[model samples]
Target: MIENVPEKAPEPITGPSVVVLDKQVPTVSDVQQEEARRQTKMDAAVAFAREKSDRVRKLAASQQSPFQGNSTGKVIIPNTKVGQGYDLFAPVDKKKMKVLFDWLKLDPDAFINILRLQYHKNPHHFRSGRIYFLDHVFSRIWRDKYPEFKSSEPDHNGCKKKAPWRGVDDIYAPVNFKNTHWIAIWILIPKKHIVIWDSIAKHISDEELAEVMEPDQWIIPYLLVECAGSGELCVQYTLKPFTYMRVTAGVSQCRAGDCGVFTLMYIECHALGMSFSPAFSSRNVKAIREKMAVDIFQEAPESHDKENNDNDENVTTYEQ
Candidate 1:
């Protein structure tokens, strides 16, 4: 105790010592956190790709025809053989078939003609009545050249073939407006009313109606007078006035440039005597178009007889 030993050197004043290892090892929690972070990144990436794909699809859908690589693109129905005595309506050739392909507006020759043939062939499906089918051009031709053909004699204008509507209950015509819109006109002969199914408008102005509906109102009665030949049919239509009407079935086009398809469908439904249902809309219109094309092809006389040879020049493959 008397010996003054130097105060033991204070222990080295160092902070808590750090351990050194040959290789640092991660804890279980550290591994779990890293895996969760990786999974989050992958999910985010997948979501981003899905959004971009959806955007591209929507844009393509807006610009192109919905029926691009459908079943309709498989093969082309051959042209009717010459001198076959095949009285086919709306025979599909290379040109006419193209209407159903390539985002083109439905041409009158291909679409309405084939439909008329279908109506005639399957009478069971159609309403039992004397329904007269007029081509798409019939109304517009009369509209543009009304008085010019008023006195031209129905025979001269080939009205003889479409004549003798002794007991015609209805007349259906597909009409085009401004060469860009399609609508259906149903002349209810007994009702003396023209019901128009316009996919574009629910109701048009009276003035517009008067102007647009003039051809039908005037020419139909006149044709009746000429073709009916002073019979009861002629007298009835001549005496009474035809009124204009717009269908109130809540049927309107939900997509653009689909007016033609809507017009054709309206005529078909009325022809079948079926009520317009919500099932028919722009949603499944592309599928409808594909079916229509196939139907037209099968209706061709050559379709059943001919073999589809790839080497044959007449047999062209369908192009999108």
Candidate 2:
């Protein structure tokens, strides 16, 4: 007699089932992938910004000096190996070059005058800035000799050469005389010096001619005067001429050992006789009056005025 008894219901699982954790847990690959994507975006942005900055810098440089381009054509400075026949040397240092450029920037008129004086003193040695210097000297000489003669020609030879005065007609004519503004002087320096066929009629003062023969204290003194009147003159201890060997050594040797000989290319353009308006003069007068009032109220008025005037002159001269 078997009584039908329901098998006791399987005991309900008491609590949560035991979870088996894998030793090698799944990595957060999706999160990592998202982070990588973000990092890539950041890098791209940085690269784009850098590229934009470079472009802006280049554009600014171009705008500042429009005439500065390789379009004027190329002038090569040939390489001279160690065993070259002549001993090559550099005539100027980097600092000196800066000084020279600075002098050129301020009072270009003074630079022109100095160059003319130098050419008159010594025409044979062939100075570095020969052609341009000659041009300035010729213009001045022509003006002095023929005050009434108003032709487009610039002749220092005193009407000797058959070459008619092709003044404004010449491509390299002075800026203000014509409505033209662009002016450039190109020089081709080969391995050896090129002989200028045109005879430079010797027109120099007795003192200058004597100094040329004797390049000692006398000549240097005259040069110093010219330099002083022009602007602040800074001369480096070392005076090196631009040369091929120097350029080669600069490229090949240790940077410190590299020579600082720059193959110079220069262009100067003037905005057609742009003069300051009377408004500027009024503004200057107002400034002067204000300054005077302040000085008059000072304890040592006379001393203050003197010092202020000196300072003002210095500032004005520098601005010019």
Candidate 3:
């Protein structure tokens, strides 16, 4: 997610005789061109990742076996979408599905870039390693995906010797549930808050949101505690320490299929510190889908990703 980086200052012209020069200025068209280049590069990366994703899908579809969970082990959610919640995801929208699918297809770097783009815009505001990597976040490993070779893990297994959440700032999680719907979770460290946003409100209950996490792992408290070790073992240090919080922003998805888009918009708008309303969530979803279709996909650790996403924007933790 490295876009719009701060450019270096121009060096002074060195000579025996000094020449007075007027202050330089960039034109509006120049600024527009630069922005276009940045966006075009992003869109190109997104498009390329989509192609790779399509190929893998076609190959998988051609074969008899189920998808191998890509490289992140996201294979399938073990029939979470089939039970009573089936009706919630019913009356599916084809266009919305395509948008979600396109988003899932992004390669890891492309995905990270989307997150990086926000950080790049406001570096001073966000902690450097604050994002919490989740299973549903679309990503492709940089070492394999990028040609120049940027390695994320030390050993071949993509495992770092230590965990990356020692002093985290903010967190971003994109989640898929029961293989049906998508949701998002964001921890606002500056505000001392955790926000859970779900597109399908009626389908997901308040009680359900309260427990939307692994049996023994709770990420909200982890951010507050000191992680003793690194990588997968880090969770042992802070396993489900009691936590309590509430949803800062709770709203329903206006349309059936736009839940995913709303989840993403929540992230984008929140990252920008902008207020989001029902109108933003309901309309212009296709635009959001198209943008996501173009950027995707990061790598840190599998444990960091095993966490699920929920709504409420508040943790509302309890002692166990």
Candidate 2 global CA lDDT score: 0.30
By TM-score, how accurate is candidate 1? 0.56
- Candidate with more favorable, higher lDDT: 1 or 2: 1
Deviation of model 2 at 59, angstroms: 48
Runs off by more than 4 Å, candidate 3: 1-112, 121-164, 188-193, 214-252, 294-320
- Off-target runs (Cα >4 Å) in candidate 2 are 1-8, 15-17, 27-137, 147-320
Q: What is the Å distance of residue 263 in model 2 from its true position? A: 27
CA lDDT, every model vs. true structure: 0.64, 0.30, 0.50
Order the numbered candidates by lDDT, best leading. 1, 3, 2
Q: Which ten residues in a row have the lowest lDDT in candidate 1?
A: 311-320
Model 1 clashing residue pairs (backbone): none
* Tens-digit lDDT track of model 2 for 152-229: 343342221132211111111121112111122222222211111111112223354232223111222222233333
Look at candidate 1 and tell me the lDDT of residue 127: 89
In Å, residue 244's CA in model 1 sits off its true spot by: 1.0
Q: Kindly list the per-residue Cα lDDT of model 1 for residues 156-259, writing each as its tens digit.
A: 43342232334677888888777667778899877878998987774355577677887677656655665666556555556334788877567656476777
Q: In candidate 2, how many clashes are counted? A: 10
Q: Write the per-residue lDDT of candidate 3 for residues 1-320, one digit (tens) a residue.
A: 85887989998978688777555777789899999999999999999997765553323343344554443223431212345855575787989876556544332223434555556556665444455433243211211222222233333333322223445556666655554566766655545455677667666666765555331123334333434445654544433334424344555465865666666667666665666766575567766665665443222222123342331122222110
Global lDDT of model 1: 0.64
